[model samples]
Target: MRPETGMSATGFPALVLFDLDGTLLDSAPDFVATIDVLRAQRGEAPIAADQLRPHVSRGARAMLAAAFPRLDQAAREALVPPFLAIYREQLARHGAPFEGVEALLAAIEGSGSRWGIVTNKPEALARALLPLLGWQARCAVLVGGDTLALRKPDPLPLLHAAQALGVAPGDCAYVGDDERDIIAARAAGMPSVVALWGYRPEHDDPATWQGDALVASAHALIDPAAWPRPR
Candidate 1:
């Protein structure tokens, strides 16, 4: 069955939250480029972007694994810092908001609702990336993976974001691309939407994530009617 569509029992959501990497930002290009740079340093040919795209949501380590399949777990873990360092240098050089994101943000603002980000990305990186997109001042709240002792799939980050926005969890809806995003929203007592356009491995399935709704693209989010309603 389709999830309920509007405000929850608490009220219409005062704030809408998004996950950074795969959901709001199309950051895979920059991520893949960074991995290619690493490969070049080792005299290895660059891997295809599509090969590493799905692992972007899973983080740097995953992308590294995809790029260097022969590396042992310890060797892969060792590349995380270098990967992030290179990524930081080229964070938004190729990154851009997903199609229709600007209009969606404008619609949210015009409707008198606040919007923010809750991402598993490190706080420093998240902070650094926002300004590159000129969203540093516009976002109402931002909760990074390091913002608290807990992260997505644990619910604390989502709950913390709602509290910081001065809105009840029931009055917020989170949009993300990962299963952990839905699990966290559910545990926080908030509704969630899965962004189908975001990163997903061939074996991954959004349908089984149990989000309140599934949106095909950012453009769909511009319409208030497309949001998940209260059950």
Candidate 2:
């Protein structure tokens, strides 16, 4: 902690932006429930949650790809509409924030820093999650994948959030679980922290993502000094 600032040495970043699925909320159980229903309709047994969890961060398409490797492209594409319909019903039914997330969020706010979400989840779906996650009024901003012309890996969402908050892009710190998350943050001129506690396949290497900081859990993120300084 820095005595004069009464904060971490660098203080918390002015804005702390997080990705949805793998970073802040552990919504995989809901996704798993959605996908398993589709699997059941085809007389297929529900796929293992372990098999589907890591890929959830990549979104529905990736989850489908992992679940139905036996299905060709078109068949899986056809499952999307039904998949989403089922997902809407299952939202937050069995999902909640990852352990330690609430405390971490409180810590960020306690430091007088604003935090928000910038996620590739669709706007309606993401908005639906706010109350379920108890973040309906706490977040300063929420930018979903469809909120902008483009989403993660495009930098637009992150930049848009910063602009909406009247913060310079460099004053924000982005946290996420995917390579695309780090890419978007970089393009938006914000330093990024890799959520190692989030999802990824065994073969995917986040070390190659080149983020400014990497943390093991939401608990680790509670420490103000863990955040990177503005660029």
Top of the candidates by lDDT: 2
lDDT of 1: 0.87
Model 1, span 109-140: residue lDDT tens: 77778889999999999999888899988999
Off by over 4 Å in 1: 1-12
Give me the displacement of residue 88 in model 1, in angstroms.
Answer: 0.4
Q: Candidate 2, overall lDDT?
A: 0.88
- What lDDT score is found at residue 216 in candidate 2? 92
> What lDDT score belongs to each candidate, Candidate 1 first?
0.87, 0.88
Clash pairs (backbone) in predicted model 1: 4-229, 5-229, 6-229
Please give the TM-score that candidate 2 achieves against the real structure.
0.94
Residue 207 in candidate 2, Cα distance off native in Å: 1.2
